[model samples]
Target chain A: MKTTQHKIPTARPSGQRPSGAVVKPVGARPVIGGASSDRVIEFRGVTKLYDGGDIGLDHATFGVEQGEFVFLVGHTGSGKSTIMRLLIKEVQASSGVVNVAGHDLAEIKRKKVPYYRRNIGVVWQDFKLLPNRTVYNNVAYALLVTGHSRKQIREKVPDILRLTGLSTKLHNYPDQLSGGEQQRVSIARAFVNHPPLLLCDEPTGNLDPETSIGIMQLLYRINKTGTTVVVATHDHAMVDKMRRRVIELSAGRIIRDEAAGLYSRDESTREFAVRMRGARLGQPEDS
Target chain B: MRFTFFFREALRSLKRNAMPSFAAMVTVLVTILVLGVFIPIVQATTGAADEIRGKLLIDVYLRTDAKPADVARVRTLLADKTPNVKSVQFVSKEAAYAREKARFPDQYELLGKTNPLPDTFRVTPINPDKISEIRNSLLPVAGGGTVAVDPAIEEVKNRRDQTAKILEATNFIKITMALLASLLALASVLLIANTIRLSLFARRREIEVMKLVGATDSFIRWPFIIEAIIVGGLGALMAISLLAVGKVAILDPFAETFALIAAPETLNFGLLIAILLAAAIGVSAAGSTLSLRRFLRV
Candidate 1:
């Protein structure tokens, strides 16, 4: 386990500490062995079957720790996208427990879904930017949803735009921007509210290799700033470059789990290669 | 902030779809104008009928045996005692006989043997509405000298009451027309709202994306609702103006034909206020209800 150097402070006052108090420094990672206690997402025996009885995910069990950048790599029909959907409560799990940001996916009220989404950011391959709205408004939308005042929005929007390298295109509409620029605007929009979790569903899928690499670098930078990042893709090259923790799925099952894996290998090593390549490069070699 | 955004968006959308908005406005205007013209005429006729009812009068006849001094005393008593009596004229037996002979010339030859008519006091009430009460009050004063009211005057009052009733029925028809007009206006609003909804549905993907990014449902609906309101308001305004012009151009000339009976000046500020209020309420209610139900889906 790679330990974060920061020390965690006591959760309660020392004078009022009960007999069971576990003393720790301020900012220390809340980890037991290699697993962190502050998991942002959890899936316990989760299953999702489509309307026609086709299985989307079959008894998936996993956990994503807070502020941890995790890659979810799988082939087509392997349930990577299903996991992402379930995490955001876009689709309910068929059975078992699925929790994200302290809300149970199965029991969360429909009206509260928007509030739930406020704690998470979603970036898409298509950018999903309104062609009529400028880049600034697109990013400002996230903050607006969280009921941020106009003054706060005005102050925060410019800073996020600058951070996402979209300051120059603040006045530009989606139609006027290139694919890469649109993705940047999307990223800015996703992160403007400073959500604790950021889910990118093939964020670099539509871009060329250079653009894909740039977007991957941007995601890498975002992940380092303590925002939990989950990228669902079959992208191999970008994944290998980042060399992050990888969870590979096959036939709706987590077939391989590797730490610091590479992009390519022989038939037996295909799992690690695919997972690593997808994580770092954001595109599988075959895809 | 939401309303501001909605207003801006609605205004922008209206500008963008100028032709359709103009069409909607015109539809609203025409409907409201029709109502404006139809309502006032009905109201004026009702007013005139009421005026006639309040100004009706009756006459009373005295017995032939009654002396001239008795007739004079009766007249003075009626003038002083009756609250409603404006004045009383003593028609002499000779004058009554002359009037009867003039009314029926063939009967005058039979009456030549003896004057069969009695003297009478033609009593006019200050207010026609008080005629019934005045007649009821004067009945007990008929002593040995018989007091008789004119049958012709009673017939005229009955005719006026019937006319007033008919005029009031016309008011009912006018109200029915207003109701029908309002219903039609509501239908128009629904149609316009459906049109806006269709436009919004065309951009469903954009809306979904907006939702995914945390835009509230109200934020999504504001622009469409605002657009409907603007369209409805403009339509109502146009209808009012057209109605005013039509009243001036068409109603004024039509009223001149019945200048003796219909007081054109009766369509005053109160009436105008009533018409404007009805239109404003009708348009606003239709627009808001349709937009909220059809477009907002709330």
Candidate 2:
């Protein structure tokens, strides 16, 4: 008999609780406290200003819990990309602290950046795949950069390609593949290392609606596993269809933070829930 | 494993960027070859000067009327008193006449009738500088018996001194040339390093991508350094080959044309090895240093 240990909420005793409390605390919701395996990214009053004297990020403080999916929605130049760059240590903040996966960004040594980044994966809007390399090599490159052995690379690359729905296009170059397939290859590269955190910056920006929904479903499936996902994009339709926690930014400031919310502002022109459901159904459940 | 990965990458990059690597190699080769030529010339000049000083000898002539006892006394005196006198050979009057006749076969007919020449004692000095010492030691012992030092030995000493001075001037020129060659070689390394750095800069996005995926600094830098080393090594090899061929085909014949200076023979195996090693090491050091600078910075 495999009995699950349910953590009991250790708040004020039921008898000592205040009278007018309408919300019942569900057994602490397994807070997932910083265990050795837990991965959490936190920003404490992080601010970034460009050398040209424009504020890129403004005193943003937030934390993404382990195994959670969150959307970072903002207009152009609204500091969404800035926050992503700070997490990767690609850009330094003007002030305040940034801690990603237990590594402090402020005092992180330059030599450790590669190691720091290895714990996280990144996908770009343009797919950022090497045009010269084949689909198989493109995905394998991530492992290669980490100095993985050839045997591991040979074993892991095919598995990742299969996971990304790119198993059949292994020999094709970026130019030979469709835009969606290229983006899938890029996604495969990001996930090949099995990084705990995956940051996607406008991954579906160039994709058509059908392909965009497919890409979103792929991300959704990946999020279901244990990886924390932070998606920075202006694609309101995809955000609305996912119906996840949305942190909306406006002019370097967080204006809205909604739990299990859909895109409700002016940018919410297209509804993708129906297409997203269809795409989700298209993939085999076991995969 | 790390080094192997980097080396592979470096070889791949070199293949991809063939033109720039080739240019860098040629630049290094030319500089090394020029330096190679100058090194031997400098060594040979110094060697020739030393050889000339060692070979110069002074001869003391005896008067025709001098007694055989006086001649024997002079020989014994030179052997005992002069530290500079390496050896003393007493030339009998008959032997002296025969030597004069050998020098001028046509003049020997007149020499038989006139008896113009005198017997001589050839004093071979341990060094050219000791020629004067031997002359001074013998002058008084001759007792105004017409003791004449061979003018040719004096001429040899003057010529040797002049040759040493000329060699000094040439050595100065060689030093300057060597310095210039070194500077040129350094410039070539810098150019190659900068060119590779610029190429890396252009592919910074690729580097960023690699970095994001956990590429170590060693992994990233190894390829660049290997590429630089390959370029430098190939350049040095080409330069040495050129030097070897030039030394044999060109410099050897030129040396033969002026065989009296002994320049060609002075360029021996030991000197060639020194020049080749210097060039190879110089180019390799320059390339490796430049490449390591960037990696060490991070």
Candidate 3:
């Protein structure tokens, strides 16, 4: 396995972290539990069948503990995107319960969906950056809609940008940045409010392999700050290399769930060997 | 969000999408300007019709050879307390001749010597529709019908055709103005709505992004609302100012052409301006809000 890089891009010159900064000791967040608590995400027999008789998710059941990083691996149309939408309450489950950040999604009022979404950050494969706004304003937009004061926005935007290694490109528009840089800007915007749960749907889907590693490392450092992270991707090489908690799906069903699991049943070691050989010989890689 | 933020954003978008915004504003301006000019014209026409209707009256003439007592009885009958009679004015033969000379001096001079006009009573009715009733009561009855003239009465000239013409003209004016008012109102509403829909449709992507970033419906709605209001309000102000200029430059100078009605100064411009501004703001806001409903569902 390739050695994982644990580097934070740069440290602050002042040596004192800002309030609500994610540089605190690990496990500082308490793992609360009982018959009903400590689960950041819970889906019990959740079935989502869209109109026209297509099944989005078929009786999927899983739970993520606080601060856990879970990899959701599947091919295209494997219900990965549906899970992200369901988590954000963008699509309602056809049956069973979906709970996110201690709120039952089924009971959430339509009027309250915006407020509910503020507690959870979401990143998409396309980056979803506003082309009209600069990198700073794109991050500031998250706070702008939530009624944060200008003073608060001014104080928070720069810190988040610096944290996301985007301080130099603050005034640059989305089109002016690289694909990976645009993804980083979206991440900055997502994490600006310090949402406790961050959900990413194929964050590195459009980036090169080298840039993809950088993004994965960034997500890893964020997860270390006690923010629960769930990433849905089809990148088997990255999955096999990282070997984190994996949840595999096929045909809208959860086929396997394991701590430190690979991307698939038996293709882990062979996929890793092929990818490492391709990287060493500077050959074109395939997923 | 801060009010300044919303206001700034609105101004920014208005500037950014200058073409569509200008189109919307111009549409609003034309609508309000048309309304501002015509509404008063309609009101003035209705008022003039009312004035003309009030002046309609019937004239009752008496025979020159009628007895003094008969004349006195006819006068008493004409002046009887009736629900429809508003007032009675008596005119002697000499007075009637003088009125004739005044009205047609050339015709009177050709007649040159003997006074041929008869004494007359001009009767005004409370309701113009009751003119026939007054005429029937004043005319003398024949053996079989009331067509034969009484010895005391020379003629009962009600001028029914002239009254009918006036009434017909007034009704025609009313119907024409009402149709014109409704057509103009509908045109203005449609123009404003179409312009607003285009402006909002051009920026649908921005709204989708806002919604995805967790903006409540109000936050998503307010900037566009403010933008629409600015467009509407600016349009109304421009229209009113243009109308005022037009009145001063054109309508006031050609006052004789519209002599049947009150002057332009008496048109209650302040009220028209207030109403125009309200409508501009109202219709544009409603248009934008309704147009945005489908897009905000993202």
Candidate that scores best on DockQ: 3
TM-score of each: 0.63, 0.67, 0.75
Candidates ranked, most accurate by lDDT first: 3, 2, 1
lDDT of 3: 0.79
Please report the interface RMSD of model 1 to 1 decimal.
3.1
Error of 1 at A58 (Å): 3.1
lDDT of 2 at B190: 65
| Ten-residue stretch with the least lDDT total in model 3 chain B | B258-267
> Which tens-of-lDDT digit does each residue in A45-156 have in candidate 2?
6679999998888766555767777889999999899988888888899986677776678788888888788788898898888765689988887888776899999999
lDDT (Cα, tens digit) per residue for candidate 3, span B227-289: 999999999999999998998898777777767434444467788889889999999999999
The sequence of per-residue lDDT tens digits that candidate 1 reaches over residues A210-252 is: 6776677677667768899999888866765556666677777
True contacts kept of 2: 0.70
iRMS of every model, one decimal?
3.1, 2.6, 1.3
TM-score of 1: 0.63
For candidate 2, write residues B1-298 as lDDT tens digits. Answer: 8677778877877776677667666766665676676656655665665565555566656556777776777677668877787887777778777777888999677656667656666667776554666666544336655333422121112244664565466556556656765686566556555655655555566655666666776676667667766776777777777777876787667665775335545667555756565555555545555645553432
Q: For model 3 chain A, where is the 10-residue window of minimal lDDT?
A: A5-14
Give per-residue CA lDDT, model 3, range A160-210, as digits (tens).
Answer: 888778889999989999999999999988888888999999999999987
- The 10-residue segment of model 2 chain A with minimum total lDDT is A19-28
